[model samples]
Structure formats: structure tokens, C-alpha cells
Target: MTKLIGYARVSTKAQDADRQIQDLLAAGVRRDDLYTDHGLSGALAKRPALDKALTALHPGDTLVITTLDRLGRSTQKMLELAEELRDRNIGLRVLNLGGGDVDTKTPMGAMVFTVMAALAQMELEIKRERINDSVTKRRATGGDLGGRRPTFTESQIRTASKLIKAGEPATQVAKDMGMSHATLYRRIKKLP
Candidate 1:
């Protein structure tokens, strides 16, 4: 039997999934067929409820979500999931996409999703190129593309370096300086 399964997610504990649930129910999904992930950020790759929902879906089943972001905020991840769903013969419907119908089961709907995904991927690539160029230009002009400030002061860094040079273990030096061993190595790499 082809079932209409719904998946909902909220980014934080304070947020509610009721609205999404209501929307899914209104779209003819059975209450028992609804899956929810609470207090889970869309940026996280692992989602237990979403996994269960996907596993429960069989070929010809429809997967529904209130919004595209509820499914995933990352364009690449969303596109990958869409391709997986397509390959598995599961349909997708987003109730709030473009404030209108966005169902992948129909030919027009599939075309719209394909176009949107392509545009999103292109936009991300362009943004990445701009950032890389800006960083390069800034470095050439001695402008600091500042990152997280060093947790250790100059005196501490000097002490740690001396200890490392004296054959003390990196892990021990980092522990003494209240930083991770990886951080100690990264700091050494930055030294002229």
C-alpha cells in the first residue's frame, strides 16, 4: 500500500513541531505515520526520526514536509536527499515551498525542483569563489583575515614551544597550556 509519511523537525528545544504536524495531517497524512525530530538542528547530518521515516517508506510512498528547511537547510544535502528519494521511487511534497504547490510526483513539479537545485548549487559556488578571492586579496595587502584569537598568550606559547623543542610530548605540552594537542600543532605551523 502506498502511504503518505510526514517528517518534521525543529532546530531547538524551545521551538514546537505542532504547526508542521498540523500541516501534514491536513495534507492527508495519518497521525501515526508522522515522524518528528525535536531540538535537532538541520545542519546536523544525523537525524534519528528522519532515518526511521526514510526506512519506513516503500516504493510509491510519498514523503511530506511542511517546508524545505524542515527537511534540510543545506542545499547540497537537500539535493542529495532528493536524488536518493527519486532513485528509491519515493515522492516528495513541500507544503510551503514558494508559498504554493511543490510536489515532485508530477512532471512540472520535478522540473521546478531540478531548476531550483541547480540555481542554488551555482549560487553557493559563486559565493565560495568570491570569499576565496577576497581572502587572497586581503592577505596580499597585509589585512588580517582574522579567525579565532589564540587562546594562549605569547609567554605561554614560548614556554610550550621550548617544552616541545626539549623533546616533551605534544599532548603533555598542550595539556599544560590548557589547549588541545591538535591546537598546539596548528599554532606551531603558523609560526614564522
Candidate 2:
């Protein structure tokens, strides 16, 4: 008989994996066939449960997952896993992709997986570009781009400078002003 393996993952302990487990069980996977990784980031390559699931897969087995994102957030990583499964002659099924079998070897299924991976990669790149643009705009403004804003007013800067000139250490000055040492250093760096 052909075996079916299920993989489930949640990035944080606060997120529940019970629903995924239940779904896999309802899909006819035995408890022993289900591998779970909780409180583990998808970016991690050394996940124990995922490693076990991959090792347990054989040429004729079917690998099932709740969603693509549960397997990995990165398009490259997802594609890598899919390719690995294909190399092993293992079948891949995702619950979100509909209840039926999805044969990656078929032309239509291959096209769909390729398009999904490309979209995921594009989304990540767009997000990174937007963040860079935001940072550039903030730097163009006279804002404190790299450090904490000064809690001390202009009067406080004048006082802190006076204290420093009077031979007080920045640490002591910050302690007296109820600010952190790093904040004091940043304030001093901004000073003329």
C-alpha cells in the first residue's frame, strides 16, 4: 500500500498547530504519519520534524501539507522542496490547492507551481524595495534616521553639554538625566 506523509509548521508558540493536525488527520493521515514543528521559523533549515518527514518520504509516498507558506515563506525554498520531492518520485498535495491530487509532473500542475513561486518571490522583492524607499525618504528629511530621538529638549542639550564640559562622564550625565548611555551617546553625536 502507498504511504501518505503530512507536514505541519507554525512560526511561533502563540500560533496553534492543532487545527493543522486535525486537518491532516481528517485527510486520512495517521497520527504517526504527521510531522509537526511548532515555534520554529520557516527560514530555519535544521528543523527536526521537517527533517524527519523528508527522510521518511520514499519514491511512491505522497507528501501532504496544509499550505505552501507552512512549508516555507520563501519562494526559492518552496521550489527547492518541490523539486526534491519530484526527484524522489514522491507526490505532493496541498489542502488549499483543492481536495484532489496535484501531479507536479503534469504540465498544468508544473505551470501553477512555477507561477506561485514567482509571485512569492516578487512580493518579497517589492516589500524590500518599499522599505528601502521609506528609509531613503526618512533620511532626506532632517529626522534622526539611525538613532533614538532625543528626549532632552534644547535646554537639556545645553545642560548636558555644560555637564560634559565640567568633567562629567556621559554615563553619569545620562544617569542624572534619566536616559540610557546609548541615548546620551546619540545625543552627543548630534551635537555640534
Candidate 3:
């Protein structure tokens, strides 16, 4: 008997996997045939549910996912997974794929999968290049590459220093200046 297995993932607990589950069930996959990974990053390799699903797969079985990105964010990883499935004579079905079925039994399906994998890889590379270029431009312009600016202003640091010079306790000065003790101490260390 042919079996169909479904895989779904969500990166955070805040995201509900109910929709994916419903879609897979609606697609005729049984509840027992579904595997889910929640609050797991796509970059992680050691997902327990994913491993169990792979282990449960037999030759001629189909592994279904709502989207290819749900399988992995890295194109290399996705290709590796496809190769593994092919070696086992298993088929892959990505619901988000446009007008093509990627079953291993057909040469055309394999070609389509290969082309999709290559396109995903190219997309990731282009995004990385754009990000690197943006970072380089920002660095050249003296813009903070860090995600956020520091909380304390130069005037606040000067005030903290003056308070320290007036024989005020660091903790008290920090409280009075509405800053944390660690912040005040760091500013004090920067003074001559």
C-alpha cells in the first residue's frame, strides 16, 4: 500500500501550525501520517520530528510539505534532503510548487525539482550579496551597523561623570540619573 507522510514546521511558539495541519489533512493524509516541528528554527539539523518522518519513510512513499522553505531555509540543505529522498526511492511533494509534481519516478519531475532547487539557491545568494553591499555602504557612511543605537547620550555620560566626581555613590548616581548601575560604571570607566 502506498503511504503519504506530511511534514510541517513553525519557527516560533507564537505561530500556530493548525493551518498547515488542516491543509495536510484536507489533502488526504491521515493524522498518524503527519509530523510537526514547532518552535524550531529552519536552520537546525537535529529536529526530532523530521528525523522520525525520514525514518518512517519507505521506498515509494511520498513526503509532503506545505512549502519548500518549510523544509529548509538553506538551498544546499534542501538539495541534500532531496538527494536523500531520491536515494531511498521516495517522492517529494511541495504544495506551493507551481503546476508540477516532484515525484522521483519521472525524469521530468526530477528535472523540475533540480531547477527549483537551483533557483532557491540563486535567490539566497542574491539576497546575501545585497545585504553585504548595504552593510558596506553603511560602514562607509559611519552608520551604526549594529541593530540599535546606544541608550545613553553623550550629555548623559557627562552628567554621570560629574555626579561621580561630586563623591556620589555610583548606585545612587545611577538611580538619580535614571540609568542602571552597570551603565553608570561603564561610563565612569571611559573617563580619564
Candidate 4:
């Protein structure tokens, strides 16, 4: 017979695991079918409850969570796990994904799951690019002094610029100066 297995996680001791347990119960998971990782981070390599929950699933069983993030914060890892579950002929159900539930057993739910993963990946890349741009601007304006100091002093920059202009390889200059090739090129570009 097919069974429904539920897993819940809360990252901190202050957070209430009962809320997720209640949600899972309301979704029709039996009390004994629920597994929880209280005060444990999803990033942790070992989650004994989650390990047990997964091991209990069979080919026709379904794994349920309140949110996709309950499984993991990493979109890539969640996608991989969802794919693996599908391959094993097990189902995955997220109770609240974008104001609704997603069950891999349904065609529309599967499509939404894939689309959401793509959207998540795009958001992460956009956030990374924005952060990189912000740091670059701060560094250029000398406003972010918290980062590592520039390895090359003014005199070294001048020498590096002249060497590069005189046909010395930027990589060799970077190696000799204890900086990166990209840094050497950027410093060369800054010369008047």
C-alpha cells in the first residue's frame, strides 16, 4: 500500500517545529509518518529525522513538506532531489509553493516545480551580479575598506603598468607581483 511521509525542519531552537507538524498533520499525514529536524539547519550534512523519513519511502510513496525550502535552500539541490524522487517512482509534494501546493505526481505541478527552480536560479544569479557590482563600485570609490588590501602599492602599479605596456605578459607580472592576472590588467587600465 502507498503511504504519505512528511518531513519538517526549523533551523533554530527558538523556532517552533509544531507549526510544521501541524501543517503536515492537516495535510493528511499520519502522526507516525512525520519526521522533524528541530533546531537543525537544512545545510547540515546529517539530519537523522530526514534520513529516516527518506529511508521509509518506497516506490509508490510520497514525500511531503510545507515548502520546497524545507527540503533545502539550494535550488539546485532541491531540483536534483525532486528529479531523483521522480526517477525512483516516488512523489514529492510541497504544500505551499507560490500560494498553492505542488505534487510531482501531477503534470501541472511538475511543470510549476521546474519553472520555479528556473526562476530561483535566475534570482540567485541576479543577486550575485548586483552584489559584485556593488562591491566593485565601493572599491573604486574607496568606500569599502573592509575587503583585503590591494596587494600592489602605487610604485608597484606604476612598474607593472610600464612592464605590461612594454610587452611583458600580464600573467607573469601578476605572478611576480603576487596579484592576479585580472588585477594586473585592471591596474594597467587605470594608468593615465
- Cα lDDT, all candidates: 0.86, 0.81, 0.83, 0.86
Residue 113 lDDT, candidate 1, scale 0-100: 73
Tens-digit per-residue lDDT, 1-192, candidate 4: 999999999998899889889989999999999999889876566789988998999999999999776787567777888888999899999888899889998889888988886676677679889989988998899885475767667788988888988999889988998878998878777867
lDDT assessment of candidate 4: 0.86
Which ten residues in a row are the worst by lDDT in model 2?
96-105
Question: Which segments of candidate 1 are over 4 A away from where they belong?
Answer: 117-192
108 in model 2: Cα distance from truth in Å?
2.1
Q: What TM-score, computed on C-alpha atoms, does each candidate reach? A: 0.61, 0.63, 0.69, 0.62
Question: What is the Cα-based TM-score of model 4?
Answer: 0.62
Model 4, position 19, has a per-residue lDDT of 81
Q: Write candidate 2's Cα lDDT for 1-192 as tens digits.
A: 778899999999999899999988888888999999999987787889989998998898888887666777688788888889888988777776544545565767766776776776787789889989988899899655676554678778778878888999978898999988797777777876
Better of 1 and 2 by TM-score: 2
Per-residue lDDT of candidate 1, residues 1-192 (tens digit): 899999999989999999999999999999999999999987789999999999989999999988776777567788889879989999998887677858898888877777666565576578889999999999999998989887777667777888989999989989977889998888777766
lDDT of 4 at 37: 89
Point to the candidate with the largest lDDT: 1
- Model 2 bad stretches (over 4 Å): 98-101, 128-192
State how far residue 8 of model 1 sits from its true place (Å).
0.5
> What 10-residue stretch in candidate 4 is worst by lDDT?
144-153
